[model samples]
Target: MTQHPMPDGRRPANQGPRAAARNRAALVAAARAIYAEHGLDAPLSAIARRAGVGQGVLYRHFPDRAAVATAVLEENVRQIEQAAAAPDADLASVLGVLTWHLTESAAFIGFLHADGEYRRSGALARGLALAERVKGALRGHLPAGHRLATADDLMLAVSMVSGAASGLTRAERERRVLAAWRLLGVEVGPLRPFDG
Candidate 1:
């Protein structure tokens, strides 16, 4: 079948540099939700449908699956960076943000170890930097005498939450997060969705 761009010779909402950027952002956002719900293995076409864009548009913005996933990971890193930079941010605050991310981006983290175009991208580097920011905030609002004495402690706490959260629902992930915090003696009220 012969396809046409449009009667006006330009497609709807997918023309120009501004639309390209918007389409790229939409694709990335759609990829995040699709990946979180369906795992990182979800088809690229799924992301296109979720973004309300055609496969051609998705491919134009992201040359491959790794490119789209890398964009999502980059978005995550930026969000964490913003959360960590808040003036009143503390250990609990940082941990809360990480907790929210654990459920949403666990597969994205695995991309750090995967060999692909994503490896060449700087997304993994930003993710590692976010770790340092998290480690730095561990002492800000921890319980007295129950503080994490070293970076390993932070790793242990994060691992517990992330490990337990694998393949679980949002509420289940929240429960696991709370248990992990208590295991480390850092009583954060409850794991809630992080807006930052």
Candidate 2:
């Protein structure tokens, strides 16, 4: 049997198990872009359209909005971990990666922060684990007697940084994160301009 295009000339989504990974990756990428631009309230149809897959493909991979949102966050953590794996990677450089993500991933941050129950999200746990490792590096870089963030301090800082980014323009996020961090006693030096 041939897999034929529909009357509109668009082929149906491939149903092979091999295609599942491709389709799932596509859905997560599309969801990330759509949510970044229009937020978590963006229509599921838009993510399907953006991924060039059907709505069924999207729903098959992700049972709900939060599930997809969790995947996006997981992907973000994976990227951070990859960056931190570099030989020359240090606390300041990794902090730069975090700053960049906090500015760009406001939708995911907002969704995860909406309720205490979301702490159960696997992404959140992976994130905390990553934060733990990053802290070891951060503390090594600190001068003698300098403060390191406690777990509670980090949790609060994330909330405040995401609060600074929420509903803010990109430039505003760049501005306000500095203010938020300053409140936590870290002075961010000059940063290179973020490309739009």
Candidate 3:
């Protein structure tokens, strides 16, 4: 096969989409682990080393720390979408999944809360769009006479759960989340225990 050299002279351009995807996944996973352990300020070089990729590969996939962080958050949104689309998923189950995710992903959540970079990079807007998708997916599951009319209402419920459960245990957070659901007039059935 004829080789097309990259401008950086480190790797060939014919690495294939699969290899590129693998590298991107590795970088995102490494960023998640390192950010969880050392916070978002962890060096890009450290992330590249952990992913077993060169700095150039990591840079090619994610131009900066905020891009990496955004990718991580985007993955989270995709997962939430999957959960919402599950056959047996209802409003309660979807909310439970989101609660569990937020509970286990405290570091990422903290980064979203503290870093203005996400807003500047448009990640926050993308996240809000995903949130709207979740809300739309759950709308059909709302109980009769319940009033979750808009995505903003759903977002308010999420804020309540996240804010109320701060510093609480996983179980406590689930309880608070369930309570928030009830308070929002969404009459969800009993929730499974949060596995996180």
Candidate 4:
């Protein structure tokens, strides 16, 4: 078999910078899958294996499992923030974005709260910033001079709606979310079923 050289010229199949980034992204995605499967105790070696990279490459990309977890969380939050900031994003758009994001964010939040290591790493900071941006987008939808004063309030309302959806089935989640959006004054008639 032909030998693959590492970009650093030290290891075989040494991928270049772009390939390294792709590998790192694959590693992070693998980490997310492993965490979802094993509840955050998933092995780093397994992550490397899943990413098809050597242990040394995984280490070079992420110092440890904690780093991998943090990277995954940060990437998730960054995606949410970007979605929130997309052009022509109105109240309905923002609500849909956040609602979808929160559905997935619960997993990361569960992992973060359970692990002390992640708490000190500022992993949650990026999530908070994203949450604030989402809240601002929601607030912008409020009627002029309406009383949605703080991000906390918006977050709480979202949490309530999301949590309420948990008790019901998929169709119920959709129904309740639409009702909640209307209650929040979002004029979600066109966006009902939140199909958008």
Off by over 4 Å in 1: 1-15, 113-146, 189-196
Query: Lowest summed lDDT over 10 consecutive residues: which window, candidate 1?
Result: 187-196
> Which tens-of-lDDT digit does each residue in 117-179 have in candidate 2?
355555466556655654554444444444444444554565677688755476777778777
> Over the stretch 4-113, how does candidate 1's per-residue lDDT look in tens digits?
57888975553577777878888887898898888778999999999988999888788887778767866765665666677876666766766777766656647656
Q: Which stretches of candidate 4 lie over 4 Å from their true place?
A: 1-14, 120-151, 158-196
Candidate 1, clashing residue pairs? Answer: none
* Model 3 TM-score (2 dp): 0.68
**CA lDDT of each prediction against the hidden true structure:** 0.69, 0.66, 0.68, 0.61
Task: State each model's C-alpha RMSD to the native.
Answer: 4.3, 5.3, 6.4, 6.0
Lowest summed-lDDT stretch of 10 residues in model 3?
A: 187-196
TM-score of 2: 0.69
- Candidate 4 residues 1-196, lDDT tens each? 1136568776565447878888888888787666655556677888888888888888898876668876876666555455546676565565665555344333454553454666676656754665576566567665555545454676777666655443223455456666776677654323211222
Residue 92 of model 4 has an lDDT of 57
Tens-digit per-residue lDDT, 1-196, candidate 3: 2245668886565658888898898888788677656667889899899988889898888888788987876776666677667778777776666666665454565554555676678776766676677566666566665566554666677666667554435566556666766676665544432232
- The window of 10 residues in a row where model 4 has the poorest summed lDDT is 187-196
List runs of model 2 lying over 4 Å from the truth. Answer: 1-18, 115-146, 149-155, 182-196
Could you say which candidate leads in lDDT? 1
